[model samples]
Target: MPCCPFCSSDMVYPLLNTLRCKRCKNIWKEGEENPGRPAACGSEGTSLRIRKKTDPLETRMKRKLDEYLTRSKGKFCFSAMPWQAGDISQELFMRYLKRCVKDRSLAEEKDRYGRTWYLRP
Candidate 1:
C-alpha cells in the first residue's frame, strides 16, 4: 500500500504521471526511487503508463450497465427507473441493449409485469 507522498495516507494509485493525492488533493510525479516499482493497480497492462485511453460512450454505457446489474444483483429494468442516460438516446440505448443480448454480453429476463432485466452472461 503506497501512501500519498504528501500526506502519507494510503491511497496513491495507477502511478500517475502527475499523481493527485485523494486526501490532500496535492499533485505529484513518481520519483527516481519509485521507477519500475510495483503499484497496487488491478490493470493487466503497465500501471506506470502516462496516458490512458478514455472509454468511449458505448463502452462506458456497457460498463455502467454491467455495474447496475451487479448492484441490483438480479433483475434490472431500464424503463422502470430513470438512471443516467449520459448522452445516449432511447433508440440507441435499445439498439445496444438488444445487441448485448444477441451477442450474449448480457442476458435477458422478463418479469411477470412485463418489465425486463439485462443481466450479465
Candidate 2:
C-alpha cells in the first residue's frame, strides 16, 4: 500500500509497474526521480510517507481494517479482530480473504501461530 504524497493517505494502486498515489494522483516509477518512495520530510506539510509495496495477506488485512476504522471516523466497532472484508462481517471477511489468497496463488501460508488459514491448494 502506498501513502498519499499530499495527505499521507494509504490509498494506492499499481499502474503499469508504477506506484500511484490515489489521494494526490501522483505517479512514480521505480528507478525514476523521487520514485514515489516514502520519505520523512522535516520542512513542512508532509511528514512520513508510507511505501507502496506488496504485503502479506495478513498485513493487507490489517491495513484494510485500519483504513476502515479511519474512514468510518471511529464508528467501526471491531477491535483485535482479523478479517478480509468483502462487504462486512467476520464470515464475509474470512471468505473474502480465502478467495484472495486463492486468487493470488498464495496457497501455502501459515498463520503467525502456525494455524492453517488459506483455502487454497
TM-score of each: 0.47, 0.25
Q: Candidate 1, 66: how far from true, in Å? A: 2.1
How do the residues 10-99 of candidate 1 rate in per-residue lDDT, one tens digit apiece?
666544456655554444554333345454344233333222236555676677676677778755887775777444455556777898
Error of 1 at 91 (Å): 2.6
Q: Pick the candidate with the highest lDDT.
A: 1
Model 2: residues >4 Å from true position, as ranges? 31-121
Q: Judge candidate 1 against the unseen true structure and give its global Cα lDDT, from 0 to 1.
A: 0.60
Instruction: Name the 10 consecutive residues with the lowest summed lDDT in model 2.
Output: 40-49
Cα lDDT computed for each candidate against the true fold: 0.60, 0.49
- Could you tell me the TM-score of candidate 2? 0.25
- Candidate 1 collision pairs: none
In candidate 1, residue 40 scores what lDDT? 32
